[model samples]
Structure formats: C-alpha cells, structure tokens
Target: MELENVIDAAVEEVLGLAQGWLGWDGRPVVFDGNAWTPHKSLRRVTDHLVDHLAEIMCRLNGLDPLPDHWHGRTVTTHADFARFTETDLEEATSRLTRLALMYRAGLRGLDPAVLDARPDPDTWTLREVVEHVAGVVYYARAMS
Candidate 1:
C-alpha cells in the first residue's frame, strides 16, 4: 500500500480506538492466561505511535534510528499502569495529532525514489515500515 494510505489508516484506527477506550480506567484489557496488563493511558499509546513515526521520519532522511530503550522496558507492575490524568491525556493528544499531520505531509512530499530506496540491507526500506505500522496498529488495537 502507499505510505499515505497506510498512515491515514493508522491514524483513523487509533483515533477510533481512543474514542472508545477513553473511559478505560487502566484495567487489564487483556489477559489470556499470560499475566500482562495491556491497558494504558491513551497518552502512552499516542506517545508510542509518535515515537515510531519519528523513527520512520529519521530513517527516511538517511539517519539511524535512535534507541528509545525506555519505551521498550516493561511497566513496574500491574498497579503502576494506572490511568493518566486529564492533563497527560491532553498533552499526548496534542503531540500525537501534530506528529500525524507531519507524517501525512511527509508522505505527500516524498519522492517515489526515496520510498523505494532501502536504508539498510537487513532491515525494511522506509516505505515498507510505514505500511508495516498500519498493520501493526491493527494488532495494537486487538491486543490492547
């Protein structure tokens, strides 16, 4: 799929999820025998999406992906993953919306050649990852 289509799909899906899950009080939205509390602030999830989009943006500009190891770490415990404050939610939504708009603009201005070019041999090209995120966003919704 085109990068723009992928990005648009992801944004729509995430916004829809956010609308539905806005009332969530950080309970375990999923627990299929495995002990994991998947529920989190919409802020957390929005922040994550923005971070990954930034990674894509950097990769598109021929830069290395920065290690945001903090995001990769697990929550301290079930209790620690509680609901976010109204302020936190507001900030996250603002940042995420800005990031999403930037992604859309970037997609509009990107050259086809740039999208086709591979950034690394072992990794996916920038375009591939953009589409991959669209797929992953769906998975994120299901698992959330």
Candidate 2:
C-alpha cells in the first residue's frame, strides 16, 4: 500500500511487541551478529524514523537533507543496557504514534509520479525511502 499505511502498521507492530518487554533481564539478543537490548532497539527504531522523516521533509522543501549524526549501531552504550521501565514503553508509544500520524498528514495527497521519482539521481525514490523506514519494525521483533 501507500507509505502512510505501511509505516503506521510497522509502528503499531513494533509497539505491540514492545508491550511485552517489561520483564527483560538486561540481556541482549543477537541479530545479524549485532547485539540488541530493549533500549537499543527502541533507539534504533525511533532514530531511523526521525532520520528518514527529516530527509523526506528536506527534500520536499527543496533543501539539502541535513546530516543526522547517529552512532551507526556499532557500539552499544551503557544506556542501552539499562532496565526498561513502563514509562519507557509509554514514551515510545507516544513518539512512534505521533511520527506515524505525521507521515499520514504529510503524505496524504501527492502526485503519484512525484512519489515515484527520485529526489536526485543518487537517492532512492521517496516511496522507497518510506518503505525502508517502515522496516524499523525489525528492531522490536528482534527481541522476541
């Protein structure tokens, strides 16, 4: 389907899995040889969403996309190993839901041709970028 529906579904799916992580034992699960704790997973998911959302906005506004300096997922921080709390879940839900809604509002109507067109020769089409962002659902599921 469209970017809005795809991203909304992925966000809800991630949140649903996150709801069950209150009992995590401060252990990380490995995926593709990368360690993922609850905090790390949540961080990756949100950061990925925000990064691409900002990229899309910048492109739409005809401005260059500013760099989002991320940790690049290679090093896990001390914060990533902290115990996950109920408040963490609530905050994640709020942030992700709001982001998904913003996607909906921002992309509600657009020319089909424009969505399929690359913002530049070096970049993916906007639709492809949105699909990649939706893949953040992998983070929550990795803990399961």
lDDT of each: 0.59, 0.86
Model 2 vs truth, CA RMSD:
1.3
Best by lDDT: 2
TM-score of each: 0.68, 0.93
Worst 10-residue lDDT window, candidate 1? 31-40
Provide the clash count, candidate 2: 0
Model 2 CA lDDT for position 59: 83
Segments of candidate 1 deviating more than 4 angstroms: 31-44, 68-80, 84-92
TM-score of 2: 0.93
Where does model 2 exceed 4 Å of error?
A: none
Tens-place lDDT digits, model 1, residues 3-63: 7766666766665555554455665544333332323434345556666787877886768
* lDDT tens readout by residue for model 2, 1-144: 766688899999999999889978998999867898889989889898889889888888888998778885676899999999999999999999999998887678967787799755888988888888899988888788
* TM-score of model 1 vs. true structure: 0.68
Clashes of each: 0, 0
